[model samples]
Target: MLEVSAAREIVLRHAKRLKADFTALMSSSLGQVIAADVASDVDSPPFDKSLMDGYAVRAADVSPTAELTVVEEIPAGKMPTKTVGPGEAVRLFTGAPIPPGADAVVMREKTDSPSADRVVIREVPTAGQFILRQATEMKVGETVIPAGTVLTPATFGLLASVGKTTVPAYPQPKVAVVATGDELVEPNRRPKPGQIRNSNGPMLTAQVALAGGLPRYIGIATDREDVLRSYIAEGLEIANVLILAGGVSAGDFDLVPKVLKDCGVTAHFHHVKMKPGKPLLFGTKGDKLVFGLPGNPVSSFVGFELFVKPALRVMGGHIDPPTATQKLTLSEPFAANNNRPTYHPAKRDGDGVRGLKWFGSPDLRAMLDADAFLVLPPGEVNYAAGAVVEVLPINRTAS
Candidate 1:
C-alpha cells in the first residue's frame, strides 16, 4: 500500500485547474476563487479626507488659549468651499475632504465655540493629525486582490470598492455522489435484518457542498454489476467529479473498482497506508476524476478530506489546495494499533489536543466532538501526555 503522502501527491499530480469564466459579483459569489489579479481603478479615499468630525485647522495657528475663526463647515461627501488661513479653522465631519491650507484637525470635544464663527482651542494641535492622506491606503492601479484568492465577505467589499461588478473566477465543480451496497437502504426507510441505512450518501453530499462543490446525490447502487455500472456511467456523464462510497475493499461483493475499470477509468492508486481508509481508490478518465472510498462512514469521511477535498480545491483555482495542518501538544497519552499511520479524532483542550473516545472506523458519532485529528505515523506508539503531535483539522482549514 502507498503511504499517505504518496497517495496525496498522486491525486494532486492528476488533478488540473479548470478554466476561468466571468461571473457577476453577488452573494452567491462567496467562496469562489479568483482567476486573475484585481487592480484598483482609483485610490482609496480618492482625495485628502477627514478621519473624524472635527475642526480642520492650520496647526501653526492653534495654541492652548487661542480662539480661531470658523471659516466653513464641511460634511461628508461634499467638497470644502473655503480654505483655512492663519487663526482660522473649518468645521468638518467624518469622510469630508480636508480643506486646503489645513494641516490638522481639532476634535469638537477639544474645542469650544463660545460665540458664532468663533472657536476656543482648549488643546494644542499637531500637524497632519486626524487627516487621511490621499492614496495612503491604496494607490491607483494597485493590486487589491490577487489571483487564487477566495472571495469572502471582506474580499467582496474590497472588490466592490474597486468597482468590480463582474469578476473572473473559476467555476465550482459539479460532483455526483454514488453509494454502492446491497445492504444499504435509504435514510427514510428502516433497514431490514442484516441491512443498514445509507449514511455515506447524504454525508458525502454535504461534504462536497461544504468544500464549495455543487453536489447531486445519485441514488444508491446495489451490489449487482449491471446496476452499479449504470449509475457509474451516468455519474461520469453528468458530473465533472464522481464519488462512489463502498464496494472498493477486497471482498466478493466489493465491485466498484472493477466497474470503474470497465467504464475506462485508469486506476491511480487503490490502497494507502492509513487506518480507517486504507482501501481508498483514486482514478481518472478523460477530464473527469473518480474516488472509490471505503464503506465505513469514518473511512469515507477521511478519504474525502485527504484526497477528494484537495482535488476540488485545485479545480477551483486555489494555489494551495491542501488543508493546513498544525503541530499541537497532546493533552493525554495515546497508542496506535498497527504500523500504518493513524488519525485519531481529537478536540482542542485549552492549548493542547485531547483525544476523544473512538471505537473504530464505523463509529461516526465519535466525530461529533472532534475538531481535528492527531496524526500518528508508523512505528510510533506509547505517546505520553504533553507530547507534541501533528494535527489535521476536520471539516475546516487549520489556522
Candidate 2:
C-alpha cells in the first residue's frame, strides 16, 4: 500500500507548470499564480490630500479670538489658487489637495457663524491635522506582490490600485476525463435493471474546474480493453493529465490495469490503505500523468481531494497548494480497526464535528452535505466523544 505522503511526492514531482499567458484583467485571473513580481509604477495617492471636509488654515492664522477671510474653496476636482498665508484660509472638502502653507484643518463644527462667506475661530486648531501624506499606502519601485501568489478578489483590487490593467498569470491546466464502466448510464436517462448512472465523469470534471483547471469532458468508455485504451490515449493527447474513473480493482472484468499495461505504462502503485478509496491507482504513461479512481462516487471524491488537488496546484504555478486542517472534538463515538487510516465525511456543529450517517463509498448524497472530513489516524483505540481529531476541509467554502 502507498502511503499518503509518498503518493503526494510522486504526484508533485511530475507537476509541470503551464506556460504564462496574458489575462484580460486581474479579476479574470482568480486562483491563477503570478509569474513575476509586480511593482508600483508610481506612489499610491500621488499627492498629499485632505481626509475631511473642513477649513484649511495656516497654523498661526488659527487662534481663539482671530478671524480669517475665506479666499478660495477647493473641491475634490479643483486646485487651490494661492498658498495659504496669515489671516487667510481655504474651504476644503474630502479628498481635496491640501494647499501649500496650510498646516492645519479646523472642523466646521468648531467654528462660529455658519455662513460660507467668512468664519471666526472659536477654538485653536492643531498643526498638520487631517492631512494624508503621499505614498502612505504604497511606495514607488516597491514590490506590491511577489510571484507565485494566488490572485484573490482583494489582491485584484490592490493590483488595480497600482495602475495594473492587465497581468501575466500562469495558464490554467487542461484535464481530460475518461469514465470506464459497461453498466453506466447517462445522468439524464433513467437507469434500467442492473445499470447505474455514469456520474463519476461529470463529478470529476466539476472537481477539476473547482480546483482551477479547465475540464475537458471526454464522455464514457466501455469495459473492453481496446475501448479503454483508445479513450486513455485520446485523453493523454489533449490534456495535461488523464483521469480515468473505475476499473482498477480486483474484479475480472476490470480492464483498466490490463489496458494500461498493454500501452507500456509504468504503474506506480495499484492500491492505497485509505478507506473509501482503497483501490485508487496512479501511474505514468510516457510523459502523461494518469490516475484510475475507484468506481464508487464517494471514493472518487476522496481520491480527487487527496491526490489530484495538490498536483493541480503545482501545475498552475503555485509553489505549494493550500490545505486547511484543524483540530476539532468529535461529537459521537465510533469504532474501527487501526490498520488503515479512515476519512469520514463530517459536519461541524458548534465547537465539534459530527460524523454523518453514510453507507460507505457509494453514498454521494451524504458526502454532498458534508463540510469536512474527520481523519482518524492509524493505530488508535476506540474514539470516544469529546476526543480531539484532525479535520480536513473538503468543501471549498470552509477552505
Candidate 3:
C-alpha cells in the first residue's frame, strides 16, 4: 500500500491543468480561478479625497482660536470649485475631493458654524490628516490581481474597481460521479431487504461542486462487468475527472480497476496506507483523470480531501492549493488505531478538537456534526487529552 503523501503526489503528477477561458464577471464566477493578471486603468480614489465629513483647511492658516471663512462646500462625488487661501477653509463631506492648497481636515465636531459661511475652528489642524491620498490603494497600470487567484466577492469588487466587466478565468472542470454496487438504490426509492440507498453519489457530487467543479451524475452501475464498463465509458466521455465509488477493493465484485484499464486508463497507484480509504485507486487516460474510492462514506470523503481536492484546484489554476493539515490540541484522550494513519471525524471545540461518536466508515451521521478530521499518524499508541495533533478542516476551500 502507498503512503498518503505518496498517493497524493502520484495523483497530482498525473492530473493535467485545464485550459483557460474568458467569463463574464457575474455571481457564478465567484469561486472560479483567474487565468491572467488584471491591471488597474485608473488610480483608486482618482484624486486626493476626504476620509471624513470635515472642513479642508491649510494647517498654517488655522490659529488657536481663529475663524476661517468657508469658501466652498464640496459634497461627495463633486470636485472642489474654490481653493483655500490664507484664513480660508472648504466645507467637504466624506469621499469628496480636497480643494487645492488644503493640507489637513478638521472634524465638524471640533468646529462650530457661527454662521452659514463662517466657521469657528476650536483646534489646530495637522497637515495630511484625515485624507485618503490619490492612488493610495493602487496606481494606474499596477497589477490589482494576479493569475491563479480564487475569485471571492472582494476579488470581484476589485475587478469592478479596475473596470473589468468581463473576467478572464480558468474553466471549471467537469467531474463525472459514478457509484457502482448491486445493493444500491436511488434515494427516492424504498430500498429492498438486501439493498441500501446510494449516498456516495450525492455526497461526491456535492463535494465536487464545493471544490469549484461542475459535477455530472452518471447514475449507478451494478456489479456486472459489462454494466460497469458502459458507465465508466460514459463518464470518461463526459468529464475531465471520473470518480467511481466502490468496485475497487479486492472483492469478488471488484471490477472498476479492470474496467478502467480496458477503457485505456493507466493505473498510477492502487492502495493507500490510510484507514477508511486504503483501497483508493488513481489513474489517468489521455488528459482525463480517474479515481476509484472506497464505498464507505467516510472513506470517500477522506479520499477527496487528500487527493481529489488538490487535483481539482490545480486544474482550475490555483497556484498553491490548501494542505489538509492544521495544528490543533486534542480536548480529550484519543486511542490510536493499530499502525495505520487514521482520519477520524471530530468537532473543533473552543481552540481544541474533540472526537465525535463515530461507528466506523459507513456511519455518515458521525460526520454530520464534524467540522474537521483529527489526523493520527502511524505508530502513535495513545495521546493524552492536551496533546497537540494535526487536524484537517472539513468543507473548507483554499483562498
User: Residues 1-399, candidate 1, lDDT per residue (tens digit)?
Assistant: 899889999998887888899988887777889999999999888989888888998888777978988888889978988878998888999999999999898888898889879999898889989999999989889998999888888888998899988899998888999999999999999999999999999999988988888899999999999999999999999998999999999999999999999999999999999987999999999989999999999999989989999989888787773867898888888876656788878898878998899998999999888888888777758889989989988775311
For residues 278-396, could you state the per-residue lDDT of candidate 2 as single tens digits?
Answer: 88888887667788899999888988988887777778887754455789998888656546787888998789888888878899999777988888777765778998988877755
Show how many residue pairs clash in every candidate, following the order shown.
0, 0, 0
Please provide TM-scores, in order, for all candidate models, with all chains considered together.
0.96, 0.92, 0.95
Residue ranges of candidate 3 with Cα displaced over 4 Å: 396-399
How far out, in Å, is residue 291 in model 3? 0.5
Report the Cα RMSD per candidate.
Answer: 1.7, 2.3, 1.7
Quote the lDDT for 283 in model 1: 96
User: In candidate 1, where is summed lDDT lowest over 10 consecutive residues?
Assistant: 390-399
- For residue 188, model 3's alpha carbon misses the true position, in angstroms, by 0.9
Give candidate 2 misplaced runs (Cα > 4 Å).
64-66, 109-114, 121-123, 319-324, 337-339, 379-381, 397-399
Note the residue pairs that clash in candidate 3.
none
How well is each residue in 1-399 modelled by candidate 3, as lDDT tens digits? 898988898888877778888899887777898889999999998999998898999998888778989999999989888879998999999999999999999998899999999999989988998999999999999998988888888898898889998878888889999999999999999999999999999999999988878899999999998899899999999999999999899989999999899889999999999987999999998899999999998899989889988899888877775455789999998886646888889999999998888988899899889989988777755889999989988874433
For candidate 1, the lDDT comes to 0.89
